[model samples]
Target chain A: MLEAREPMSAEAAEVSRPSRRGTLYRGDPGMWSWVAHRITGVLTFFFLFAHVLDTALVRVSPQAYNEIIETYKTPLVNLMEVGLVGAVLYHALNGVRVMLVDFWAKGPRYQKQMLWGILVVWLLVMVPGAYFMLVRTVTEMFGGS
Target chain B: MTLALDKPRTPRRPAARRNNWELASWVFMRVSGVALLVLVLGHLLIMNILDGGVHRINWGFVAGRWSSPFWQFWDLAMLWLAEIHGGNGLRTIINDYARKDATRFWLKVLLYVSMVLILALGTFVIFTFDPNFDA
Candidate 1:
């Protein structure tokens, strides 16, 4: 603990560089949704940007776009597809939780309980989805008729 | 102000603000994200790689793709889900970063407007796509 404290002291000075007063909402557990929504939104947006660029290449030259699309036909692309959709789904679902907070459904008192609910549902849905993406399709694709 | 679930936790005050919205938004992101996982990944596999690849995709392909009610519903679901999920995610960002209440409100108005427009347009395209316009 002492060693951990020693290295962090220098970083702590940087961390505490304060923003304007009244601007900063001292965070609670629920507030993390607001933060995560931004992070995952931005991450998903980045992938979307790449997708648009790839697809828009069709507009520039259909061949070029098709060529790119052809490359995405690979197993690597399947994994990427899974990742991209996973990112979008997680961001969207957690974002809904954040919206519920806005409407005042789950508060600080129930934050922990609601967070667990969120996790449970996320895994439940995503696991099946992952199977659909990674296992079922690949099995069908590669396994000979 | 406090709201009670099992029992009334807090007394109703005349002008109490609200509880945390941030949490619900977080939940939305996760839930919709899981749905998208299925919709989007299945879409990619069926469309891009399952058959002989992009060469197999053409006008008849487009018509054939949408022929399935399953794919149509899947696309429709993905379109609206992504839009709402993305829109709500943006709303969270706005609440966090937007400085003024007026600014936040107006920005969200714009976001929601765009969301509705895009959602409508995308759905319409899916439902009424003309695969044989030049045929």
Candidate 2:
């Protein structure tokens, strides 16, 4: 029997349901971009919450907060920090593009150009960001106890 | 674009009145996703790794980084990316669920309003943040 092509109402009831049609990322820029934005944004939201809570730990007691901060000083911890900042950065930049779409700044012909524009902007910011972050790490290593 | 001229006829409303919002949204998600992978991953590697760790991050850290045009650009990139991603996702949901023209229109207006305000506020925060604020 041939499988039903259209998603059925019952299928909607199931959680974590993915259609047989290959993932939408196979499509064009907007589909995957939208998905990435969503996944990253959700992740960012939770991470932001955690960041706030982690910082707030200091309010309870300096010793408690310092313990968490000390652990975050490791290489592995630094690695995660990169991921965190990256998530925040990408999500933020892409968010602006999405907002522009509302106003009709990009059309079919301009779509590719807009994508490239976003890339250039990302690079412009990232290079300096990386430099400063590195400098901070280096300084901390040599300057502090 | 040619297909756009060929209208989907419905007794209720003319196709001309209906814009190609859905198709544009579909395209946006994909493009944004690819960018996210690259930009976000790169951001992570640089901030967390590359040198020391979190203890290295402090007030001077923010000042030292932001003072440069480069990190300012980086913060700008991250800020724009997340905002667009989130706003587009919300747009998709609005179009999918909202039915009545008035409802959809107003909701979208509200969405855009909040979106702009947040974008402005966040951008200001990134650029104006002072690492040297005296406690």
Candidate 3:
């Protein structure tokens, strides 16, 4: 029965060819950087969107705006604010790297070095920022309470 | 093994001409991304790190900031650039993942709707803000 089957036509084979969908983050630094970039970009954008809306609430009524902002003063929200800072920092640093890659002649060759540079700068900025944000908020929330 | 070979497929539609809009958008992403770094970081520093952090953000603070043309313009630029940059980024994601034409079209429709709504509301609030409104 197997030997009785006819060969498939060349045109049929071409028509049935599968499209290539690229691999999803298989450990390449460049690929992972872009993944991080996209995620951080999306997170930051959504936060800003909500932020604008809430800020605009000031125009609705001062009381409403103040009330909403007051709620943002909790320790939990303050902690989350630290995360927002981290996201913004990563996105900004990676963005500069991306700009260089697009325009700088030697950028692609030096991308790995740039990534390390970004990491060093990120830690330098973020350590102090996280410290200040966490310390001040915790102190304000609990130091007097 | 079967000896069938693949045949050449019909030519795809001709590639579209590169227009000024495409070039502008490419430029806009890098330029706006850089600008956002400064504006957004300054904003975070002022709003979340200086003078008691989020506690300092209040109706009065917002009112005072908006009263100044400098702050108003600063926020306006940040708002416009961030929204467009974000929307464009999402559009690229949608184009990449939404394989079906209808899916891509509807997703973009939703994106544009939200973008326009937010942009309009944000701009309106910035310029027409009347801090003296009766509560």
How accurate locally is residue A125 in candidate 3, as Cα lDDT from 0 to 100?
Answer: 89
- Winning candidate number (lDDT): 3
Please provide TM-scores, in order, for all candidate models, with all chains considered together.
0.48, 0.45, 0.84
What is the CA-based DockQ of model 1? 0.08
lDDT of 2 by residue, A48-124 (tens): 43553454443345455567776676656655655666656666666556545444533333544565687688788
lDDT of 1: 0.60
Per-residue lDDT value at A55 in model 2: 47
Q: Best-fitting candidate, measured by TM-score?
A: 3
lDDT digits (tens) for residues B37-110 of candidate 3: 89999998888877677877889888888889999999999999999999988887787789899999999999
- Give me the runs in candidate 1 sitting further than 4 Å from their true place: A1-37, A43-145, B1-34, B48-59
lDDT of 3 at A120: 93
Docking class of 3: acceptable
Instruction: List the per-model TM-score of the A chain.
Output: 0.65, 0.67, 0.77
TM-score of chain B of each: 0.70, 0.64, 0.86
Clashes of 3: 0
Whichever of 1 and 2 has more TM-score, that candidate is 1
User: Pairing residues by index, what is the TM-score of model 1?
Assistant: 0.48
